[model samples]
Target chain A: MINVENLTKTFGAKRAVDGISFSVERGEVLGFLGPNGAGKSTTMRMITGFLPPSGGRISVGGHDVVDQPIAVKRLIGYLPENAPAYTDMTVNGFLSFSAEIRGLRGDAKKKAVSRAVEMCFLERVLHQSVETLSKGYRHRTCFAQSILHDPDVLILDEPTDGLDPNQKHEVRQLIRRMGEKKAIIFSTHILEEVDAVCSRAIIIDRGRIVANGTPLELRRKSEYAGAITLSVRGVSASAVTQKLSQLSSAKRTSVIAENGSKVTVTVFPKPNMDGELTRAVIDATQVWQVEELRTEEGRMDEVFRSITMPDTAKSPESRVQSPQS
Target chain B: MNSWANIKTIAKRELVAYFASPLAYVFIVIFLLLCGFFTFSVKPNLFDRGQASLSGTFFFWHPWFYMFLVPAVGMRLWAEERRVGTLELLLTMPITAWQAIVGKFLASWLFLGLALALTFPVVWTVNYLGTPDNGVIFASYIGSWLMAGAYLAISCMTSAMTRTQVVSFIISVVVCLFLILAGFQPVVDFISGFAGPKVVDFVTSFSVVTHFEGFQKGVLDSRDVLFFLSVIAFSLFTTGVILRSHRAG
Candidate 1:
């Protein structure tokens, strides 16, 4: 439903978005991943027809963004970064105004506004001015405005940046529901959100597309893929390490944690030898009193950092070892 | 046309926004106070003149009042939108740049017209005192509105070029000062010394004050109306160009 071809945006001597191309199909949610100044917002702006690209073309719903901008805009529901909205107007008033500008009139306009208000849970604050709403409520109000017209494409830049944890989950669920039909493109620095909601992901760095794939595909690129972690009690750390070293096909073994009589070890399997590594760890578990044994699918953050960071700046120690991490 | 619908939508929203803020009330109160003070308390008071016409008291102060008040009403047209980041949301909508520009200008122009209309008591007072020439008063009112539109057009255009309302107001005041001074006798004489009388006449013709003079004498000259409309059109055209360039950059 949306296509961007070799899009480039230059500001004086700096290229904010270099030649990058990506297309989003119907019912696909593309998660845009990047750090600060990664040109994520800039790319979304170009696709939404807010900022003109220096070179290349963007088409939403088969309409050219530059040549048929009004047509393209009519089909897009865009939530700008920071959720900027008119503060002086009431919540109901603002959404109705947005609906009117989107070409909704009379009964259609009233229905759209009410439906958006319901979707965003803005009924309580509908009569209240936007300036008086809390940060989360303000963000929701802007989000509601984007979907007011029920457009075919949704291009949101950080849809849950300032929301609390519960609000973020609700918004993610809302996006997931919307993604079942519309073409959705949302940007975020939060890696877990990609795993939760995106069917496909694109990671950009310094105005370039560094990695693009499904969530599972990107995770598989990590070094920890198919690695097994063993935490055993009543087993000497050195003994476990010595026994694991004797096993063949094991790429590397590292001590992740050691506490008195308990030790946690991670055994990495050589490429395409995950079976051998699993067998080896299980055999060792039979010999020792194993407290925990789990396979490491991979960490998205580690994969993201490895792909975007320079070789010399790699920080393997920064990986979170918690269960969800 | 669809564009006209877009314009009306934007203008209605802008007008509502104006009334929602305390600034609009503050501006109206100060405008009414200043108009009453200038007409009744200042020199050449309407009662003291003993003339049946409102030209000396009412229309005389409009050019001076609008030089400052019109910019105050118009400086927030685009500058506030840009400063608060709503400009991004507004321009990204289905409307074109020209529609947004014209819609905002008209909204502010209409607000200024409303403020001007509130001073109708001055007209009522004139009629009660004597049999005044209603034609001249009506023509002067039309001229005042057109001239205010011209001032608002320039102010709105300047507001689009900057994100600071104060900077927009200052630049508009400076430009408006040059427009008013072009017709003032002392400034025209100073320029005539270096240039020629023809140059002075051209400058005088361009001044808003000179065209407004024809209306004060009950003359609805097409040339004067055309001049004001042309100024409004030129400013709006330049505003559209600036906004397009902004998107390009």
Candidate 2:
């Protein structure tokens, strides 16, 4: 439902969004992951027709954002990064005003306002002024305004920036539910949020798209497999490591910690490992108590750091491990 | 039909906003008090030699009255949107700039007119004390309303230029003062000494005061009507252009 082709936005000599291109299908939740100054908001503003693109074209539901801005704006609902709202207006008043602008009137306007108030859980504070609301409530109020018209496309820039953990969870659930129907492009720096909510992720760094794929696909492409952390009793760390080294599936093994009778060993296995390695470790270490054996789940943060950081600047010890293999 | 819908939505919300706050009441009370004070105390002494008509009392102080009142009403028209970040929401709406401009201008002008009408007790008082010309009274009211509309349009243009209400008000007052003083006798005299008398007369003819004075004298010349309407149209048109350019940029 949203197509951005080589969209570039430059402020003076600095390129905020440098030739970034991406398309989002209907009902797809695409997470735009980027650090600060990565042009996530700039790209969103271009799509919403809030800011003109320095180059290229953007179309929303078959309408060009530059040429057919009114049509494009009609199709998309945008929640800016700060959730800027009129502080003097009450929650209901603000939503109703937004509804009127969206062409919702009379019964339809009233119904849409109430539905949004309920969806954002803003029922009790409907009469209260927006300035008096807490940060979480303010964010929710903006969210309600965006969705009051039920536009076909929703572009949320850091939708859960200042909310509490519980509020964030609730909003994430709401976003997930909304994603089931609308095309959602949410920009966020939070890695776990992408994993929790987005079906596909696009990681941008320094005004460029560094990587784009599903979370698992990224992990697989990253060449970082799950590691097994084992705490063994009645065994020396060196002996355990020496025995694990003999196994073919064991890419690398190291003793993470050691106490009086217990030792923690982290084992990096080959990508396509079978059960042979686990069997070999268990069989070779007699009198060794297996306290913990779990694979290390790859986090989005790790993948982000690995791809964003310069390859030549990697530490020697990290280079020798070669987790991608 | 689309423009009507747009105007209805904007006007309804704007009028509601005015009534929701104390601004409308405050403006009306102050407006009536000032008009009464100027008419009973100031105008009587200044025009002691002449017959006290609505033209001398009401129309004389209108340009000055609107200089303050119009800015108070119009300063928030666009500045408030920028201050509160609602400008983004408003611009993103499907309505065109003309709809928004006309809607806001009409709402503000109506409120100002309501404030001006509250001073009818002064007109009633003048009618009671003496045989004041009713035609002159009617013309003065029309002139005041047109002048208020003209001032409001200028204020809207100034408000669209900045996000600070104080700055918008000050700039609007200064611009209005310049327009009013452009036709004053002393200013014309000073300019006539430098330029020719004919040039001074031509320049003074463009002043709001000159046209407003003609209307106060109970003459509704089409030229004066067109001048005030032209001023309103030009300022509102400029406001639309500025807002559209800002939105596009």
Candidate 3:
């Protein structure tokens, strides 16, 4: 378990992480989503006790980070951004060193290293120097080190940054399996990863928490949540748009595109009226030549973009300098 | 005592890492070559002096050799860690700042002692040539090791203050040069002109060269031992402060 209260980190005139608070319960995988320079890494560093907070408090496993940093660190298994590691060391050597520092010895240390190696799929390259391994292997090696001690809390910054799709999937599965007992928090710019791995998600921007919810909940916030697209043949663009606008469940309607006699219309439904709207569209199209009709489950990418870049959404260029200045 | 485990974990890793790179070999070879060159081939050569003592020829080259070689070791101790981003991993471990500082300093000190040990051939050769005072040789080796620890402590502190190894090396050399030259006769005379005798004595007491003089003369004085140890302690303490501050940054 991890509790962070009003944590803040400032670098001179820049507030890297403004007052923010979040808790991660055991068995929960909290996905930290944010853009570059959005304080995700800074938050991770503060929680790990690697960087001191300018204000507020962080306690891991009931130990105050500032007062009991060593104890707090003992409870944490952190993988720093870029997975920085001693490149000269072999995979086994680095893991053994990590295990030793984590207070394991003899048979326990050997067992921990081998278990981590197996979990991270690092067995094949265990004897090869990290510098000679490919980027994905190096990343996995660092991942293996973080989990070597099996700490109660795991804080990873971009855990799957440079991995291939299969490696990424494997890592996600690994995180999912580990999430059964660990309070895991990982920051990533990859949106789809949150859906795949995180039980809960927190979106941050410009040193602030912009949104927090489940993946489906975040998707529901998108404007396309109850919207539908209709492609009709043998109808004028304006005619189809008018017919869709007249429906009782339709909140708004607009023509998407026109190709000769075929037209595509986007219909926005009133709150909690997607079912009625779909049925209404089907009835209205019975008389017309209906080429295709589809319902949207909502766009999470659009939701994320809008939530994190609201200033850029309305005024695009004018708010480009808002976050920093 | 578990803290000892932490220290050993760090020190052993550091020592292994040192020997894993070409830097260790290059440094040892250069150290042996220089020590041998100064003892046998240079002026005041061991054979030319016709004296059984190595104090003038052997111990004389140490402070000078350590001035550069010690920094080469200490420069990477913290600066390289900071540069490569391993400092984050290291300091975030259960170990405290003092442990990491002491652990790294001890690793470099031990490596320096190993290099110093390789010159045992000089000891044997001198013994074969004449009846040399073994006590003086023994005391001088200890003194040289303590002095190397002092130099390494200063270098470690300097390295902790910066992320650039080159900058760490240059600044450490400059500081060690001051510590080495502070008690020289010319420097003492120059300082005595503007300060009182008590102040001059205090300044001389800070000199590595002055404290080391007692050991080269075969005297295992507690004052010299205390001075070298105090210098090492003070520098290592400063290194802890720098590391802590950097972590806070």
Best by TM-score: 1
* A303 Cα displacement, candidate 1 (Å): 1.1
Q: What is the C-alpha lDDT of each candidate?
A: 0.90, 0.83, 0.89
DockQ (0 to 1) for model 1: 0.83
- Clashes within 3 Å, all models in order: 0, 0, 0
Q: At residue B94, what lDDT does model 3 achieve?
A: 88
Structure candidate 2, residue pairs in collision: none
C-alpha DockQ for predicted model 2: 0.48
User: In model 3, what is the error at residue B143, expressed in angstroms?
Assistant: 1.0
State the DockQ of every prediction: 0.83, 0.48, 0.78
Among these predictions, the greatest DockQ belongs to 1
Sort every candidate by DockQ, greatest first. Answer: 1, 3, 2
Flag the better candidate by DockQ, 1 or 2: 1
Q: Give the docking tier of candidate 2.
A: acceptable
Residue-level lDDT of model 2, residues B79-134, one tens digit each, is 98888777776766676668888999999988888888887787776677687888
lDDT for B144 (candidate 3): 98
Show the lowest summed lDDT stretch of 10 residues, model 1 chain B: B240-249
